[model samples]
Target: MMPQQDQPANPAPLGLMAFGMTTVLLSLINLNIVDATLEKSFVLTMALFFGGIVQLIAGGIAFKRGDTFAATAFSAYGSFWESLAFYWVLNSEPIGLAPAASARATASFMIMWGIFTFLMWILTFKHSWNLVWIFGTLWMTFFLLAAHALRGTEILLRAAGYFGLVCGILAIWASFCILFFEHTGVELPGASRPL
Candidate 1:
């Protein structure tokens, strides 16, 4: 008799997958904004640069492991601005221009991601509506707030800080869900440390 072959288990629900990917993507995105907005501080610069790279790498690894949704989410945002950062560094003459351009870019990126998240949430409804959807929608609001804050609006800045903190907390919670509930044999690429 032929030996039986083991099939890969079905992946997590779309909502859960989207939740994990979005959380990771948004966290890194927020850090990028903070890096551009904050004054010239070495510690912050090194932290953001290295941290963002780590997150991007993790996202790539996750994608390789079959988390296509998250992999794309993390890698797309990671590469998008990281490439921009490199360009900005290479063309260093326009000092003031870089920050402004970064802000605008971040804003545009956030808006697009927000829309993407919404669409993902809608698709997730086909699976089941749950806390994941509720929190996901609320979480996307932070992106809108961050986009406004990057535009130099004081109120939006405050809102962004508040919302960003909330998003971070929610992300940690989602990570725990993936860590505890999902039984994928492979370890999550970025679970070892903060990204």
Candidate 2:
């Protein structure tokens, strides 16, 4: 038999860290803890670079590693970030697409994303508790934020922001787990083995 090709280094940690840090920053704004002044571009920059572009690149690497789940998750969420940034730009004064989408439209977007997250969360059961919790809490965050937008309720948004913050923390922890495992060959408590 021919020799197997050498495998590339793990890229999931980079993907997870990108998504996690971006989620935390946005959650802070959603929780109204950040200044509105940075709302215009700071978020957009992260969305396009770290969240969108880098995540997508990591997803492609996962695909090369034959990890369909990682490929899907990274790519989908990367697209989500890109689409979100595009939406913001489309409605901004510079572009003026269609007079900005309504809160209901945004709610619909979140609901769709919630459904997607729940579906993916179901697939995480065999992976690890960390994986399950990450996607599971993310599912709730999306639905809760959607509910708030649809109903024009502030409380749900706050609740969703807190939930998203938790998801981010979990993601960051998982990322560190992968990176540490690669370095020291020790698995972190709740995280799964690297893909």
Candidate 3:
């Protein structure tokens, strides 16, 4: 066997930070505390550019680092953000603006994401409980949002937003933990530094 070479750096923090910040901003809008039209446009831009493109790059790096989980999670969710942008933008059509997606369609879309998150959360147990909680809450948030969309109720959506906020905050904290772990050499409360 060839001698193993030094591995590349971890790519999780960049992807996690990108996803975390985007989620926080979007969750604020979902909470119904902001102007929907403006915030949505801005959020879509960030989703396409930062969340989509940047996370894709980070996932590529993770693949180079030989991390299957990071590669899969970051790349898949990056594509998800790009798909969200496509829905809001190109969905209008070449001739005339199409009608908004039906509630059922939207709910189904969210439910699919919930399913993906559930699968990813199962993988996160190997990383740390902090990562697990982030994915766990995020999984629930998607399902809650989907249920609210299906029911046409603000209550459930708002609840999902709150859960999303928690997920976002936890993700950011995890990113920080990974970034600073080398220096501190001690795990933060409810956080971990996965290799």
Superposed by TM-score, candidate 2 places the C-alpha of residue 66 at a distance from the truth, in angstroms, of 0.5
Tens-digit per-residue lDDT, 85-144, candidate 2:
888888788788857668889889999999999999988987877788899899999999
lDDT of 3 by residue, 86-148 (tens): 777756445235567888998999999999999999888878878899999999999998999
What lDDT is obtained when candidate 2 is compared to the true structure? Answer: 0.87
The total of clashing pairs for model 2 equals: 0
Candidate 3 residue pairs in backbone clash: none
Model 1, 122-169: lDDT tens digits are 544433233344346444664755467476665565555455445545
RMSD (CA, Å), candidate 3 to true, equals 3.8
TM-scores of the candidates in the order shown: 0.51, 0.92, 0.88
lDDT of 3 at 7: 70
Clashing pairs in 1: none
For candidate 3, report its TM-score: 0.88
Looking at model 3, which ten-residue stretch has the lowest summed lDDT?
90-99
Which numbered prediction scores highest in lDDT against the true structure? 2
* Clash count for each candidate, listed in order shown: 0, 0, 0
